[model samples]
Target: MQVHNRRATLTGTVDSWLDRQQAAQEAHEAGAREVNNHLHLLHMALPAATAQ
Candidate 1:
């Protein structure tokens, strides 16, 4: 995460869409006027047993 001029820039991988939204919400709660969420969703392959 990078912060400049009250803007929070987030760059990383998240497991779900909810996580990305939560990150932005937390940034706003932390007093960030602007939030740039550049979070990428990570899709993990499930194990054979789990896939079933």
Candidate 2:
């Protein structure tokens, strides 16, 4: 019973970690896309930027 409880605790901890990691990955990806979109919009607005 003790071993079983320990296993359960470890599993829960690992699951939580995985959830947090996935969320962080998603947030990072979203931020990167937002930055890219802003840059693209800026490039479109400025013709001089396109020349460089």
Best prediction by TM-score: 1
Who wins the lDDT comparison? 1
Q: Give the clashing pairs for model 2.
A: none
Reference-based TM-score of each model: 0.81, 0.30
The lDDT of each candidate is 0.95, 0.30
RMSD of 2: 17.6
Worst 10 residues of 2 by lDDT: 34-43
Candidate 1: pairs in clash: none
Query: Residue 4 CA error for candidate 2 (Å)?
Result: 44
Candidate 1 scores a C-alpha RMSD against the true structure in Å of 4.0
Cα deviation of 20 in candidate 1 (Å)?
A: 0.3
